[model samples]
Target: MNPLAKLDQLDLEPAAKTEVAALIQSLIEQAERDAKIIQAKDAVINAKDVKIAALTHELAYYKRIRFSTKSEALAPLQRDVFEETWNTDISAIEAEVEQLQDDQPCATVARPKRLRAGRQPLPPHLPRIEHRHEPEFCTCGQCGKDLVKIGEDISEQLDVEPAKFFVHRHIRPQYACRACETITAAPIPPAVIDGGMAAVGLLTWMLIGKFLDHLPLYRLEQIAARDGVSLSRSTLADWVGRLGVALQPLAERLAWHLRQRSSLHADETPVPQLDPGNGKTKKAYLWAYRSNDLQPGPKIIIFDYQAGRSGRHAQQFLQDWQGHLVVDDYGGYKALFAATRAHPETQYILESCIELACWAHARRKFFDLFQTSQSPVAQEALNRIAELYTNEAEGRDMTADARQRLRIEKSLPVLTNLHDWLQQTRLTAAPNSATAKAIDYSLKRWAALMRYAETGDLPIDNNPVENSIRPIALGKKNWLFAGSERAGQRAAVIQTLLGTAKLNGLDPAAWLKDTLEKLPAWPNNRIDELLPFAAPD
Candidate 1:
């Protein structure tokens, strides 16, 4: 039936055996050709990878020159300056130490004592009692004036709503049919997820604190304990995990929205995820994508986390995305945009990260300048860069088309001059010089890195995404890593919702709760209504 199978089933006599062997050899050659074709396709992928790596290498900032643009009056701070800043009342400490034999206080500072721990519970089910008689007294000693109660203004303060486990009361009241018609007294509520314990509000609160606010679950547990509530960190982790599963559809839609933009900014930061089977740990990647489309549409930001920085991972994550993607020349992205079906798409454009190759980084080549702060060369670079940024800042609010045109008309000449001067400066500059290396990097990646200026849709700097990534970077110091792969994705989903809410200028808790209740019954065809940019009623 099959060509290869036919080779095994060949019928021939003794004389014809040699001819049959020749036929088999031809079939083998055909198989070899197919293998070569596969390898050729792989080669194309490799070529793209090489190009991306080359670009990424050019953009990566490795060496930095610590330039001091400050004047000599503000020299590098002494260690004591830090000591004085960190410790309270330095002069008081010195004077007190000098006067004291062992330990003595001059005076005690009166401050409200802060409660550290322990909470007293209220008595159960106490009913309110009110006296009919007026209790207020007049300011006068005698009956000079009598204060009369005209109207009672009842004010209520909710001091405590006690930490309690929540239960969704679903009342399914049945009705009997009398005249060929049935009636029911209760209506069912459409929950975000069926049989899910986590309410959307509580779930979003956990995420906002964990990701957006960089509060670790353990710390959250501590905070809860202080509030007379005790929730386990493990339980919190599971809550986030389940939240991720629920949000996957939205995350995919977000990625799709990001790709629809004219361009996107992407970056990756490392996250440590635990490995259960091996009793060891492994690396995880938090890949972030941000895009603001000004074509009469709302801005969208999406964050994703993958287990590894593999080329295949990028390909799969961005499977639905197509557009000009602005990213540092990461090889992972190169492989993705190469062999994947999204490859060769006319809408998909790759713009290089040129802002990273700025004069600020190049100026860092001179460490001595930082030590002197008064160094003229370092000051010259700083002054030049300051002017460029100031000029560009003026165009930030303009339309993408206008921004592009302005960059070409106004900013192009400054970049051209800076590029030429840096090349000339690097030729004779010291090889080991920080200034020289920075200049060299800027020169090499000048074209690709500066590509942002070519279009108004792209930012002059990759700051929007970088700013978003900073919270996660800071968070790693406290919470550290995900306990597992699914945990990392959970973090990503929470971060996405929080970040999107911030973009929409809505409270994260409110949005998450609304979304959860709305998402399940949400018409799959009308998911856009849930997007941050959707029109309000």
Candidate 2:
């Protein structure tokens, strides 16, 4: 009790003020300690990043050095193939060396053919005509006389026509009994028995004759008469109109199904759409979408037509589609990529043509420069590019993933080094300089350009689609454009069936004939099955 009273008495007004100051000083010290802790945390993050970079560098170094050669450049700096033969007269020394070493005899070298740089030869020969009739007596007064042949004249021309086919319709009749109203006479099982028009076989021929073969209706009518089928251009057009209506549902479904696939290739070409308002015409666009069953999934291809080339056209086709969609570097697809919003974010179709970037295209650019003094870079790139192709040609049939893995393991380093070398050279070259220009091109689209090494399954080029569109391009040359939007739509449907039939290894005319005659009676639930592509042989 005495100690507690003494302690309470010591806490007077002056003592209380001293004690409060000490408490405030301790709180300030704790704040300083927390600041040091935060600084240490940042330092740790910085140290970790440094280590990561160092390890990455070390790994790359080991991988390159582990290879057989010190430098994994695409190829050696020197060119291998001889530009010209300079055979030394060392045959005696070669035989002695071969005898001593038990080696094979030295082979003789022959010089390569030299191109004669000159104007190409003129036409083979002049026309050989004697012109037998000479001049007779001339008229003096009002008397009849003969005249001499005038001086010979020569005119030369080369003519070309667009690729063109014919439609044949065989119309068969049917009779029904009104007494029973049940029994009816019909055409042959596969003949054109519906709607009392062209026979089944004729319509089929017409479908292929015009669509697959790219023949105009007028030409088809002419051919049909020769073939003993009396089909008129107008009647063919009318039947085509009906055919379009009948197949619209299938065509629409085909387009939808093609878009649903995960990975697809796309291309577009200018289409001339006829003008109804004025007699004038405007250039529209027909877009193509193709899918293959070989690598990624089941194959499907479709062509889409539109009034204009707006980005909206692309958006409309790809609106709900998601996943890999291969396309050229067109700005129209930007909105499409943004909208798909796929989870796990696989590469966009923009990356699909990666496998087609090969030595062929790259090498073609430098062909003229190969033997010139400005050839080291071009030749090096070519040789290294050749290595990648050599690998591809050897392993092209392998799966895309396997092929990609091999590239990453083997060819990837060479590509990387080649790309790096090109990049460095590009900076020192002139803007208009030829070598500089070549290097710049290789550097710019280099990555997108060389995607071919990724897999063998992809096309070497966009040639298939190009080949398919060639018919339409030819048609454009002759017919110029569709007579109406309805005609354009009809072209799309007939082309779809004919093209699909061709793709599926069937005779288009036969398939078309069978499909048209039987499609009306085909079950609604099995509509998709009746499609040319999906139909059984």
By lDDT, the best candidate is 1
Can you write out model 1's per-residue Cα lDDT over 86-141, one digit (the tens) per residue? 33343343334333312323212222223245544444454445445545555445
Instruction: Give lDDT tens digits, candidate 2, residues 289-319.
Output: 7774436533555777777777788777766
**Model 2: what TM-score?**
0.57
Worst 10 residues of 2 by lDDT: 78-87
The parts of candidate 2 lying over 4 Å away from their true place are 1-194, 227-229, 276-278, 293-298, 338-383, 432-461, 534-537
Clashing pairs for model 1 are 65-364, 65-365, 68-370, 354-449, 365-434, 365-435
